[model samples]
Target chain A: MANDSDGIDIDYVANLARIALTDQEKERFSGQLGDVLKYIEKLNTVDVSGVEPTAHAFPLENVWREDAAEPGFPVETALKNAPAVRRNMIAVPKVVE
Target chain B: MSDPLYYRTASALSRELEAKKISSLELVRAVIERTRAVDGTVGAFISFDEDDALARARASDARREGGEALGPLDGIPVGIKDILAVEGQPLTCASRMLGDFVSPYDATAIGKLKAAGAIPWGRLNMDEFAMGSSTENSSVKTTANPWNTDCIPGGSSGGSAACVAAGEAPLTLGSDTGGSIRQPAALCGVVGMKPTYGLVSRYGLVAFASSLDQVGPFAHTVEDAAILLQAVAGYDRRDSTSYKTDIPDYRAALQENRGPWKLGIPSEYFGEGLDPEVEKAVRAAIDFYRKEGCEIVEVSLPHTEYAVGVYYIIATAEASSNLARYDGIRYTHRSSEATDAIDLYFRSRAEGFGEEVKRRVILGTYVLSSGYYDAYYLKAQKVRTLIRGDFLKAYNQVDALLTPTTPAPAFRKGEKTDDPLRMYLSDIYTIGANLAGIPGISIPCGFSGDGLPIGLQILGRPYQEADLFAIARRFEEAHDYHAKHPGL
Candidate 1:
């Protein structure tokens, strides 16, 4: 219905994911992702209407630990690989003027 | 001393090291030298810090000298897949995105391994973010199949298997989401085992797919895999998904007699796209179990056909969320082409990821988008439950399920690179084990006409890894397949 790109638009999805694709990638991905989507259409045929979704293979209650803070990784170790570090803290581009 | 130390199993090396016939330093040096000599063509390693490895080895030797030995894995050289963090070492995940990202701490599995005195040797290669069936998707290196240089070693644990097969490392850890471990082990002609989903900790291991992703071992023999699994399998609070259950010594479990238990041969796995030779080999393995007094039953995992589809949707969806950490502000590759934060995210990711990764991320975003989330993601998850139910029902009759690890042996490099769908289908048989949270081991079953190896996958019920090890050991001890290493 509405200029079908296999039921979902690719360009908008890529934008949401924050990935910049070239014009060629956009076309290739549109066709390729369309094919994958079509293949997955086979799932609609299966009678899973009543079945519950299993987000994890093994479902367990969230584990909690003791309330004492152990000597964790040092600040230097944390900032060791920062692409932009100033004053032992990660420096990011300023958001507001 | 006749065979190189790198070729020897960690179990054997352990015995030798304990008996003082060889020191850890000597063993480490021998393996390092072997890796240096052969890794030029195998491309199994992305980084091998000789000084760091030696320092670890020397420390292990000092402990041993002081009569403070750890355990069976003491001083054994083990390769870590780059996805598993090693403190002070670059956690590349074989992607340019994290090329400069140094881990602040070791993975839970790595910590267990270090406590057991394993020398974490090098960062092995994998598919970028463990997305592809072949290591050709590696953003950093192209690891060749050690058996035949032209063909691919299966992936995304290709380098872990290849390095072991090439005698570059005795044992290595790999992560299997669909079939990254077992498939590569099959293609590279070795033993690889994926524990039940929560059997090992995932903390500090870069996430690909949270539910299906599991850390496992690649080894030359079942016993070696069991030993390595023993060291890493346990409860860790850091990984909430890790099962807090009694840990069994997998090596001790290997000695258990594989009895009159029924073995299931799933009819679906041997269906249409199955290779004749691989089917023959796997069927012969089934018959071999029968001859060894195990009952053979023709069981059905009816939803096996939908495993690949379900796996792609779920794995990519999880990956889309997991990989959102790599923005320009963090400890990874930054794009100099960006003028703003939003542009920074776009440019950094586009430049950082490889073709396959970008494709999956886009596909994932599409499925989880507004109108399609229920149609795709939720539908796939429900199908996943049906798939899991199939295994649970089949386990009602059989103790374990048998199938070919892959449809065919290793294909020549560049053969299936173009078609993403065709490549995804290579994981057909092995994907079901992961979806069900069942333990699966792929051992060297036979050789193809091309001299490539075939693997027989044995899938066991969840938390029955010890029994799986016992069954695998039974087959391994009876056959000479594990003894036949690839001639590199």
Candidate 2:
């Protein structure tokens, strides 16, 4: 959980993002993102006291649709882009090995 | 040089088609020939099928011959930004991850375009996952500004704008999430409109920032933009966010709603970093409105400086979440160098994404991570509320705000490539509208001394695109800026 002086822990963040980065990327991004973070620090000047956070421009709630069964993309069509397919399902590397 | 059929506006082409003076087949061929001729230098399209486009044009001609034309857009070919799902066509988003991916079904917008008999043309390039301002982030190829081949077409919708400006297509569609559509449209000197959030369905658009992302049109004229907007705009049950509102006749609104309307000039937009030429052109546009009997007022949107910071946090945070669907197991790129399931995810993404994408994903993950969530993410949302409030407060005094679409015209390629922060500032003016969920349009106003195009932006109240179009049309008709095409 320890972070660099820029307040960003690139290794930890990249790991959490589940993307492996080369050593060069880690260095380059750390410097670039550090500069960006420094610029973003300007947000601290704005007083947001008691201000409500807006998650959406116009937040919609309880958008209910008909709960009826309808045809979707056929399994073959859905699996058309899979790297590997077996028995009509996407095949993946072993998870529990 | 005389204007070719390829450079005609969609509205003009529609009139000629109705008069039977031209066939959709002939028009499509001209566009295909134009694309083949200039695309070598412009690099506007990632891929296009001449045979498929020709066939669709023939179908439109057949429908017209039988006295059953769909609409004004019927028989016109519209270039599609590669991010949208065009069923059975490539949907790359200009990224390596989906390099081989073909859409299984049409996006709601694409379906609507097809229903209008508008042929879905080529796959236009964009910033990989619509993450960058310049199309340079595109893994495919950089789309050059058609005006000057060395300058970058402002993007992630650069290809969409460049195609129309280069006369390759009369109309095209681009999604604006923090100025993706407007900036490029401004840089490329075409009419690019980002409708009120949820005004157009996002069912098929690849999400970057869900709240900020809205699909819009890039066209040669304000009226052409209106025509394209009319075809694909409306509520879709599939996209819960698609607002249910009265869809007006935007083209008719151009002539009908001619105004002696009130306009505002936000003081913050005219400050430093704005190029002199861009300022001069936009100021001239404002003076035109004043001369036309419209009351002009100086307004303040105090949170203008904070827009870019707020956008990067919110947009990248959303992008990080949305792009999680691109795991190696499914349709996206798979890594052969994986030892296990977890290894596959890491290696595939690391290899597939470009530098900017990785940077944003990392920044997003950090801000949303456990300890920093409230500090960065929540605080940004609150600031976002303030930004939205600033625009609404101004709207009470003015009908709409007029400003420079971009701080400057298109810059030479590689100028800002090394500096990501500098690149983000290029979207400074257009981001406010998206954050506020309001409608905004960028129309060709004038050109820089270097001959690059500059744009004038007009922002309107939510769902009031008629007024927005009318305001822009006033200036468009006053001058022949929209009539000027890139010398490509």
Candidate 3:
């Protein structure tokens, strides 16, 4: 289920991504992403030892705001764009029997 | 003949509105007419509410008539890239996932624009989820380069740039993640700036790569861009990452901070793959500054070659995580064919996302997948550190770094769509600034042999946008490139 070609297992990765790719899309993406991965291997040439990872350009500590409740979106506004609304709540398919 | 009202810069329009020579309603009508006349070919707008725009314009006119105008941006109509939430406006990221979705609230940037008396006019198009370098990835429509309708307006801020270039709007807001704003602005021959990472709050901007994403402006001139930037910049509690520095008056700084400053030209950016015309124009610009008593120094970014590679890995990895919220449950397109919850996640994303978005998500998922994190994602982050270090080291010696915004001018539609690698390389020159988390501005430097516009990019230190704008304004004052508009 993994590492079929180009170091990316299409089925395994697609499953992880929660995407159901068509066969044609899988083929096209596999070849294209393979080229990108090959290009990305250039990162291997850099000596990154002792270099710190930069998650953001600037550093900041934990940002804390006053723990007070403020008015939020009303129920109708919150559900305005919901695909399925039931009794002012988003309704999803049944997950458990 | 005089230029049309739609083609005038916002600064000039502001003075006209103050003198009662033109009403905001008149200007809005002229812009609406221009959009109707040319957007058929440009495809810059996804949707615009004419009555809403007119009503806002009338309110602005009333404020002016009462001598209670807000500021420079009052009565000005700025186009909004669809990536930012404009309350009640369609918040499509040019993706089918949110095709019918309406914004529940205004983005912090939009709130500031409203407070400044600026009307957020229309929803501009972009690459789906702000993923591609070209607007061709937009599921709604491909925004053509207004300079030559056959070519792409470089994206994911293509519509923001195109509308200004097409004279449909005097100003626009665009999010830059890995050169989304600057690259398109380069292609379309307008002034676009990406402020320092935390300069403008990103509260309502749909996340692409959170670390790299920033909100900035597209306008006809550096002065106008400064005006627009002034309106939306400042700290907000909602966006904790936003900087808390004192906000400078960018427009006033343009005139006050004149300098024969030292500018750096990175040698790595001048090598192979750069179109000779772009290089020639950029070199000429360097020579222009040199003749104006500014010193030009050659610097090395060293890791420039790895930028595209580093960007793709990091940006897609973040995008994959940020976009996971679209699971057909809340405000996104739900699959009609789903039988179960998991099936809904799979089928809805499969059907809703465009081709490029799907490719990036799968690739991102693979890199962050178990056993591959250290090899791909972690390594990319380390390399990102080196890239940022390179810019910081260069800044220690020079006021700013100058380079070509893109390798070449705009390419014909469908040229690079087949090869994702080729398309990724289009942002090579502009990606470094984003990775470094610094401010970058793209101004029209020259035109290609084919009549396409070329951009000269200026990269400045983090939170030093005023100095950058001042430097850009100096170059702009000596050239008429910014004043030139595309003939539609």
Candidate 4:
């Protein structure tokens, strides 16, 4: 796990996460990528025989609450903390031109 | 002001509330004052609603005056983890994404707590979307350990653990994706229980990793946690993953006397990477348990080594999918200068999510995407089965598995921040239980040389929290670990 093969594109990850990482951060994180990948590789050795793969720790079951309508928070109070709003609705800057 | 009640367990507080010795308002006030004083240093709370809490406490007092019987936790102030939704409150998982997202409804756990007369004090801090092991990942602020201000409070439930340790709240609600609850609890010297996966409902918890996430309680004592769990655990129709099984009275289960019990020490847990001080503290705990009439045996969890690897793949995959909802349209933050709605989705998500979250999202997308799905995601699931099998195999021969909760005591805030892999390794001793969906608890064993707390984790079979609590309680009763405070 070194900078020997195709390096993990730190810039691509930074773009995905939207943070402007300093050059040092990119270099440091890039160098450490191999260790992360290598550690995950170690998990391949476990022998899973006759064991059912569990997506959830509990047996797959539906937890349903009553369908009856309950009183909800008033819209005025609910929207009180909105950082940005317009005409009783949470407003965000116009995304589509 | 009879006795000025300091360090009262949730159970004891409930008993006092029923006995009419302490008014709910007084308790609420005391907790608010304590939180105000220490929260500045601990950074436990992102938001503390003192006025609302007092209002609720006064109402509870009115109920008592009107001869209306209150619930078990009637008027006990509980710090809610920011990840759980509280109706009409901001449900920020310590991230900029949901900085303004208000929950229209209460989470099932919060509803249950309210029904039990537990006053919601405030939203505690946590890792952004419960991603990292330390509270440093929290976009809001880092939660400092009460024991030492410089050291980190283990996270993504770091604030919850810190609040309990600092005596700001007698009990706090936290969610465990991996060791989010147990690890922080250990580091902060408090009792944290990750109930059997389905024991608590996930109806209103903001999803981090859906498959692995479960809400649990953090408290100063095991009985306090048990009492809180009794009120919160049960089937919820809203949460499809919630169990339909009967909700047993966990408090009663704890009261059942215990004698000799089978305890398994997984060899892999005691191997290299464990700090010498943590090892000594855990060994002393095991010895104490043995003296309390428990049979200790060496057990092998052959797949234990693969736990962290399997957990990362599965948790990241789920996180990637679950977090897809944050594309800026229906809820929370949207970027200002997007050229179109599609750009809004992409730009908002890219800007709103923190670095760690984006890293995970990308990793998850890579694993679950078209070509690599079978190779990474499916393979990880197969290994997850083996990890569960290992637990089942060991449980067949022993009653419970005991191990150190963390590799070391609370580390300094910036110690592993630069090294992501080293930080991930901290969860090595804890991720297996989440993978296997078994119940585990972290109880304070002793302190390190520098006086930071050390925790011993006890893992039990699915739905065997009763046995785990019994063993943990017995150990607590015999040893004085719970009695020692951080001198905050």
Candidate 5:
């Protein structure tokens, strides 16, 4: 598992997170990453027999509520906190080039 | 009158309010004054509206005068964690990115609080997006533990916990993604409950990791916590994930009809990483419970040690997807000098989020990404099943599981800030409850030699919060853990 690095570059992680890390922070995090990975690897040793995987920590069955639409916050009031809005919708920089 | 009104529990203040001994407006004024006095020292609040709180308090008093029925939490001033949206209030998750962002609407929990006549005192500080275990990760400022000014209050809900611990507010609402509520409650020496997931509505709570996040209350006493839970819990149509079940009267459950409960003592919870001092205090608390006729049985939750690994993978993977909305365009912070729109999305988020937040986002992305999905995220979910089964197997023999809320009591500020993995391990014992979607509460059990608080966590079966509260109340009655307050 230690050698199964599919180009998991530290820079790639930093870039994805959008944080510019110092060389030292990167080195330190890399070592910490190894420790975390090693710890998680221990989970591979557990045996499961006839275990039904659960998504939530509680037993939740069909959670359908009445479909009646209730009064909601006015759109104008909702958009009041938006940093960028245009024509009643939240505006963002156009993603596609 | 010299005593701080903010420190008084909701249960205590409600009786006064009901009897008209102290008007709700007077309580609001007292809280506002106290908040102003200590906010600078503790960094408990982000935004406070004294006028608004007073207005609500006046209305509450008017209702009382008119002989109108009041809710369980009527006239109580409560702190809302920054992550929970309160209508027209700045809902910054203590992050720079959302500094200017105000909520257009209230979160379901806040809405419930308002309906019950609880006044919104203000927004409290938190780990940005509820990320860190220390409130230090808040982009704005650090919230000091009221117990010791130099020490951390414990995080994500640090500000909420500190306010309640320090008497800023008797009751505050905090969300637990992974021990955010319980760990902080333990560190600050207060009662915090993470109800069975889906028990509380999550609508309008800015999602961190949808599956793991559940809003709960932090209060001065177990009864107050139960009452607050009663106010905010139940099925909500607005939140699809909310459980569709009748809300039980938690206050009634705490009235003590049941007794001599069976408590499970899992050995893994007491092993290696536990501090000797914490173990000693917790052991004493257990002995007190045993004297109260509660049977303590040693049990094994074999998958318990694997909780931390499974939690990070599942929580981070969900976080990565949930936080994708913050691309610098729609919400709070936007970056300049975007060569184009795509660059704006990348650069804005890059600049807006902090180091720990970024690390988790990256780790989340990697786990959820194509190549590693099966090995990491999928495997974690499967392991999550095993973890839940372990709890179920133990519950079949015992009523509730007892463990130390945190491996150790609160540490000094910046003690483990540099070491991320070590910091993550702090939530080890508490994380499994969240992953398994069960209810857990952290109540002050005892104090360490240096006088820091020690917390005992009580974990119960799904939707069995009433039983959990019953056991906790028995323990509280036997030992005066709730009576010990910080010197602040």
Candidate 6:
């Protein structure tokens, strides 16, 4: 993978994603990420001015299910995989004063 | 009959069950025993619940004895890629992020499978979070190609393909975000399909990239794949993306003899980086179609080279958004050392994610960030439209397109892991279909000189999976590649 000197700051990207990477990962991924980005440079040259961006493969519009309330997962089942639980609710570290 | 029963196709097993010559319990036992015998080397399953599977099989046998058989998939032993929830089963997605998590409910596909009396038995291995091209990225299991333990069964559906190929399971469900199912199926010498994006419901499939992610099946025969597809395809209220159109009888479609179909050969797919042997095998398959009186026309998808780049931008952007929920908040692994929420988010994600996953997240976040969004993500989406238009335009002239499922057969383990770009290119030939929101199937066409299996890919218009499957069975019925198995 070439450096390409894309001037991209990987640490900033990692920060936005809230992932703490070791210094080793930062150095290695910087070059690897650059190579991946360089490949996308081909997209910059394509004339896509009038093209409509297709977000879904299908052209269908919004589909709504019956609004009637239905049975949902049981409380215990909902909380089963929670890393921290307090009285059947997910426990999170205090965020605000 | 001791072990040969394990190697039979689901169709054959169903026949024996219908004839009352064998019970579902007997079939389950044979497959479980085979798993125990060979899975240590194959590493095809993340978890196998032998007791529960046998109980389910016993119930299926009870139903059949009462003359209440369900459907084609009844009494079948199937492996499920860990990405889909199967109620009370471990839903790890072969990742550490969801460590110890057990699904509380079955996914829509699993619900349909259960309704058809399919005994979903094992948690098949996959690339962690379905992120890599090889199953080596799985934190819990290192799945190997049953064809040769030294080589990879292409992934992130490696375990699903390997299990079917190794005779451990007659059928398995695998999710393809970008050729995950088809690539591995090609490498393992089986059949794998990716239905039109909206054709199969993705409800309960752990999202890697929502738009590209679809649940399909891996089987030893194309007809069996059709059976599995029929059992699972339809409208689902749970999935907004699932198409509401009437479901067609795929097996009946196979019998329709919609032959002499016009096929397109994409010249771009055969250029540089294609293995010479793979090229020969795929071309020979095309020649076979030509001999069947099917018109083969040379077609061009000029923007094919930009697919991987455009795919990464959009797929990673969606993945970045979807994965944000795993910030050690409600469900999943949390960092034990964190004293605050912010610290926990960073440390937990950093520790739980594998290398490839982290790289994708970072790349995705960067592309969608404030200034780069227009330069990357949005631009990629526009390019995506062009890519889709490319397929639509080419489809106006042909009923289907034929190409190699992969650039080559499965490579040796650890061969391209360090080179991320090199690994991403492993899916080069198959990503165009996903980007275009169409359906594609991979069938074993021939073998590489070294004895590894090669695959032929057939792609069709959206919701035209039946056409793709019809042609697949046509070519499949004419060859013995689908019948050959690895010497496991």
lDDT of each: 0.89, 0.92, 0.93, 0.84, 0.85, 0.91
The C-alpha stretches of model 2 lying farther than 4 A from their native spots are A1-5
List each model's interface RMSD: 2.2, 2.3, 2.6, 4.2, 2.7, 2.9
Per-residue alpha-carbon lDDT of model 6 for B236-352, expressed as tens digits?
988888888998988899999568899999999999999999999999999999999999999999999999998898989999999998899888889998979899999999989
lDDT of 5 by residue, A1-97 (tens): 2235334577876666555567776776677666677777776776644656667765556765577888876888767767778899987666565
True contacts kept of each: 0.79, 0.88, 0.91, 0.40, 0.57, 0.90
Error of 6 at B69 (Å): 0.8
- Report the C-alpha lDDT of model 5 over B297-392, residue by residue, as the tens digit: 999998888999999888888988888888777666887767777677767776788877777887788777767787878778888998888899
Model 4 bad stretches (over 4 Å): A1-32, A46-52, A61-97, B1-6
Weakest 10 consecutive residues of candidate 6 chain A by summed lDDT: A1-10
Could you give candidate 3's per-residue lDDT for residues B1-488 as a string of tens digits? Answer: 17789989888998998888999999999999999999999999999999989999999999998999998888999999999999989999999999999999999999999999999989999999998888999999999999999999999899999999999999999999989999999999999999999999999999989999999999999999999999999999899798898999888888899888999999999999999999999999999999989999999999999999889888999999999999999999999999999999999999899999999999888888898888888988999999999999999999999999999999999999999999999999989888899999999999999999999999998889999999988989999998888888
Q: Which docking category, incorrect, acceptable, medium or high, applies to candidate 6? A: medium
Q: After superposition, how far is residue B143 of candidate 1 from its true place, in Å?
A: 0.5
Candidate 4 has a DockQ of 0.35
lDDT per residue as tens, model 1, B1-488: 46777788888899999999999899889988988888999999999899988998899999999999999888888999989999888889889898888888899999999999998989999999898888999988899998899999999999999999999889999999999999999998899999999989999889998999999999999889988999999988888888989988777666655576789988998889888999998888888889989989999888888898898899898889888888877688888888887898999999999999999988887778887788789988999999999999999999999899999999999998878888999999989888889899999999988888999999999999888888888888889777777776
lDDT of 2 by residue, B1-488 (tens): 25799999899899999989999999999999999999999999999988889999999999999999999988999999999999889899999999999999898999999999999999998999998888999999999999999999999999999999999999999999999999999999999999999989999898888989999999999999999999999999899888998899888888789888999999999999999999999999999999999999999999999999999889889988988888888899999999999999999999888889989988888889898888788989999999999999999999999999999899989999999999999999999999999999999999989999999999999899999999999899889988997777
Cα deviation at A76, candidate 6, in Å, is: 1.3
Question: Candidate 6: lDDT of B380?
Answer: 87
lDDT of 6 at B81: 94
**lDDT per residue, candidate 4, B88-140, as tens digits?**
78788999998877778899999999998889879999999999999999888
B91: Cα error in model 5, Å: 0.4
Q: Report DockQ per prediction, comma-separated.
A: 0.65, 0.69, 0.68, 0.35, 0.51, 0.65
What TM-score does prediction 4 earn? 0.92
Cα lDDT over the full model 1: 0.89
- CAPRI classification of candidate 5: medium
